[model samples]
Target: MSTYIRQIKKNVWKWKNENGIFSVKKYPTVEQAEKIRLIHKELEYMEKPFILPIIESTQEDFIIQPWYKGDHTVSYRFKEDRKAVHLLLSQIHDTNKLVDWEDSNLFYSFNLISKWQNRKWKMNEISFFIESHIGWEQTKFLLLCGDIALRNMKPFNMEKRTLLHGDVVHHNFLSDSSDYKIIDFDLAVIGPREMENILWMHRVLPEINYDIRLLIHEFPHLEKVVRRYKEAMMYPNELYREWLYAYSLPKERKQKFIEQLIPYTNKALTEWPNLCYTLSKL
Candidate 1:
């Protein structure tokens, strides 16, 4: 009956104070953020001294977390933790072990995620969800953030590895001078790291204004392996470059590039003999 509730129902809810926020995207197509917020609330119901942020309450139409109040952007940032990232990976792997797959994980899959809940379209699947209804390849491999790429690894872990944030990306990790806040676990499937989130950066970093030399110079440890993957395969220059994405190339060229990358895929199976058993099945 409240204005906030009405706006939220229409998928047009905004923060009570949307002063400096530039990009404001609501649930977008329909009422989904509300349902997501609700599920998080239920998961935290009857708990003492909530570990996560205030996710939901009958008092507010939607959940709102503290956001940054600034206009400055970093020109040169340095991350100083390698062990923390590996530790986060271990935590994610452990937590991810507990969850099964759901339909919402696929960005391209349709029918599997279609749902009409309480008279509105809602998405509740994890990033690993498959479009298929059943099976091992369809379900087991559908886990979000399972793909192996190093750029998705965050150099910091502030939530202390206790609370399950489910999704981890640079955007979700916030800091003021020396502290970091993990935000938006609403879409989380109770466990997993940044498979999709990391892929987003890995997929887009090249297209953005990122400095590749700087990226390699500072984040040398990870890029070493990525560059090696791109270089190891004895394929055409164009496709081999596209395969190990320490950066994102144009999608318009993806198909042609994939054609170029196939030989390397074959070569990868050849050179990485230990992985030959697994690659053969693919």
Candidate 2:
């Protein structure tokens, strides 16, 4: 049997052999691995276009599964990919009845407002440094958005709570000819499903040039919920989150990321008001 090994990312490795390709990720603890294993089991029977992972084994702090062979949905600019992601996410949320994750410490209740407040505080803590790099104008704009977003924020309907994928970035959805799969449950939690949808919009809106109308038209199911939370969406959550994350990287890497972010920051600033207006009318 021939085998080849490659490191996919930190703490994750991929191996290909005569049988097939497989992924091995080092979980922080055996308990965490077990939790994820249970989640996979619950989602094992989801419908097509929502291919679930097939766990091969879990031993010690290592959980292994077949390495899904496909490019991430982020690589495609088609509406079909987006639709597939939403469909899969909807299915996952619908399956909430199958698991009682609330009792698990790993899947705690989410507090949107408190989390936003904490993130805002962190941004303020590094404001001076960020301003130096991105200019006072951009820094002030982002902080202002954060403030408004917080003010506009409302508590989620806890009664509608379901399993949230937590991180709905496009890269988490993979597609090949045969299947479209959602991966990476490390950030998964039990929360309002709408929160997950909001995160998804934040990630995809920029890609579509922040066209609120176009976004709603593509996913009409979101129109009502999105309109209800328009005020929160008006805040540039993605920009602030990216900036804060870039701040933690090594100096050179951080500088490079900041440089690339400048154009996006400027564009978002220019479009912010219009997007808010469009959402308001919706």
Query: Each prediction's TM-score against the native?
Result: 0.33, 0.93
Clashing pairs in 1: 102-129, 105-127, 128-142, 128-143, 128-144, 145-195
Root-mean-square deviation (CA) per prediction: 14.4, 1.9
Q: Which regions of candidate 2 are displaced past 4 Å? A: 71-76, 103-106
Q: What's model 2's lDDT at 51?
A: 46
TM-score of candidate 1 on Cα atoms, chains taken together: 0.33
| lDDT (tens digit, per residue) of candidate 1 on 102-158 | 323312211101111211111113212222222334323212112221123223232
lDDT of 1 at 129: 22
Q: What is the lDDT for 279 in model 1?
A: 23
Worst 10 residues of 1 by lDDT: 112-121
Task: For residues 1-282, write the lDDT of model 2, one tens digit per residue.
Answer: 889989989899998889888998998888787767778877775545354565666376787878777854444257888788888888888876776767666677777767788889999999997898778988898799889878877667877778887888878888888668888888877778888888888888888888878878988889987977877677677887887888889977987888888888888888887887888787
